[model samples]
Target: MTDPHLDLAARAGVADERALLSAFADNYRAIFRAKVAGLSEADARRSPVRTGTSIGGLLKHLRWMEQAWFQRVLADEPNLPDRPAGEFFPTNEDTVESLLAEYDAQCEISRRIAAAHELSDTGVHHNLGEVTLRWIYVHVIEETARHAGQADIIREQLDGVTGPEI
Candidate 1:
């Protein structure tokens, strides 16, 4: 039941483009966190879809999403770390708290990257040729919000929770 660190109101005073983009992405990320709050690790691993979109898996995927976009796409890091097997699924070692902590930390790293560069700063995307930090922000917002919606549905299936609640 930890209150999400980045308050939605943090965007209120941020006039810079980078901070604004980070605020939007972080807001959605927090909403995703709120949806699965208080669930046990086992409960978090419950999947309601044939695609195996469990809350834990969604969190793991999101953490990877942030890292992949920022480290790989934005920074253009050459040697990427090996992603573990079932990177999207919840392994025995993966906990709700652990995934959430990684999400929070990854969000922080994203914010720092945005702060350091302009919206026009371009980097090499793995699939796409190149994209700006602006595009990355918008893309993260879309992707994070999409997964947050899924988390909402899965949470409702588990305990009648319906909204992001943040």
Candidate 2:
């Protein structure tokens, strides 16, 4: 689904902190969603990349990231369950449906967190000290988009699917 938030941010310009932050959050989700487009559950799990990127792993990372920033850092929620050993690596076992469901749920949580906080809301990063909600949003957008670019390459190599084209 297209995110109107990102569109709104685009119109508002990145120089505006609130609009930039919102757009960043929206863009992160859009990038993740687009990476899995037209792929079956099994296909998304396939490790098409020689490096480490996988659609499933990417989704998992997105989940980890959102929870880390919003729920854990911002809201001070209890620690999430630790990831299993070697979970970051690419694997064939992940199903597209399961991954997609997880992604959607994480995105929903992110939306709620964003809505509940003002743009100036602050949180302590585990390593970076205090930061504004706007910073988290921008960071996530850039980080996720970077991975999405990788996903685009991997998907193309796997099935000749070019991003923004098909």
Per-residue lDDT for 1-166 in model 2, tens only? 5544435445657466765666666765776677687886665767765766676777777777777788877777775775556555544565777667777897789879878998788988779999888787877777778777777877877788765421
Candidate 2: where are CA atoms >4 Å away?
1-9, 14-16, 89-93
Worst 10-residue stretch by lDDT in candidate 1?
A: 3-12
Model 1 misplacement above 4 A: 1-16
Q: How much is the lDDT of residue 38 in candidate 2?
A: 81
TM-score to true structure, per model: 0.87, 0.81
Q: Which 10-residue window in model 2 sums to the lowest lDDT?
A: 1-10
lDDT of 2 at 44: 70
Relative to the true structure, how large is the alpha-carbon lDDT of every model? 0.81, 0.71
Global CA lDDT computed for model 1? 0.81
Instruction: Kindly report the root-mean-square deviation of model 2 from the true structure over all alpha carbons.
Output: 3.0
lDDT of 1 by residue, 1-166 (tens): 5555447536447567766777778788878878877887778999878998799998898888888888789987778775666877988888888888988898888787777888999999767989998999999989988988888888888888776444
